[model samples]
Target: MEGRLVLALILGVCTAIPCHAYYSPSKPYVPPTEKVTQLHFFLHDTVSGKDPTAVLVARPNFTTAFNNTPIPFGSVFATDDPLTVGPNLTSGVIGNAQGLWASTGQDVLNLVVYWDFGFTQGKFNGSSFSMFSRNTITQTEREAAVVGGRGEFRMAKGFAKLKTYFADFSTADAIMECNVTLIHY
Candidate 1:
């Protein structure tokens, strides 16, 4: 009976003892604010020569050439027209009409132009050129163009304008087009 009493007393004392637990307050999370800028690009052709009017047909050729080239991630390539340059070099008729598009968001603040004819299959024999212009309120005005043979030619240009806070922006003119050397891989 005495042993039982002692054991009960010991168990009671053990159960009554307090245990300390460690804890700390959680820190508040904060997000950083990012500034966004937007810009629009327009490509058109304005040439006095016979090849200048060939832009319509050249657009599709350009698109085909671009599609055949390997593009890096986070970048895209496209064109308003998707047809052959023309039935023949002497046709003097433009078939493909030009069009434009706005970037998905304000993430694209700089414009980089690239031409890939290195993979062109035949030799460029035709004489043609393409012209383009850029217009912006807070940036310097600029123009770009390229002229090359009908077989295999490669040209690239890059343009960067001042960043703007507005979401609506566009170029003053359209991009130009010319003959491209098609490379068969």
Candidate 2:
């Protein structure tokens, strides 16, 4: 009985001994940086010459400093008009455009441009614009003149042009202050 009791005590002590396993906390992951080469804005008229006519009340607004520089993440660009019924009779045209340029960081970049037209009381009638890649712009220089000439119809025939190049993003501001000449011919 004495020997059995001693063996049981030894077994209990062995079982009570603690053993530890290895573990490690995870490290946060981060992405690399990219560079932007160029950004350009182009305006165009969608309606044909037979539609309503329009005139330009303001010239094109632009930023040339970053024209040939590298744009980092979180970069932004914005434009607005505070005139009342500048072109459309019922409401005014207000717009804001923003962009970011990156290289290897991420293959895709998000670009948003918004326009509101309706009444001063927060009512929106209608508006139009577009979003696209920069590399797809074939005729960069002629895009402005082509769109400017088409602006003859005011909002009735106005359109926004956007094109994203390799690592650059661009947007044209909303064209305002133009007479919509009705065609009866």
Per-residue C-alpha lDDT of model 1 across residues 45-157, encoded as one tens digit per residue: 22223434212222232333223322211223333332233323343433332332212112323333333222211223332222233322223443333333122222322
Q: State the local distance difference test value for candidate 1.
A: 0.31
Q: Report the alpha-carbon TM-score of model 1 versus the true structure.
A: 0.22
For each candidate, give its TM-score against the true structure: 0.22, 0.19
Please state the error at residue 43 of candidate 1 in Å.
Answer: 3.9
Task: In angstroms, give how far residue 116 of model 2 lies from its true place.
Answer: 11
RMSD of each: 20.6, 19.1
Residue by residue across 1-185, what tens digits does model 2's lDDT show? Answer: 99999999999988884556365666886643322112222222211233311222222234333333232222343223333333332343243222221221222333232222222222222321222223212233112111111122222323333332222233222332322212110
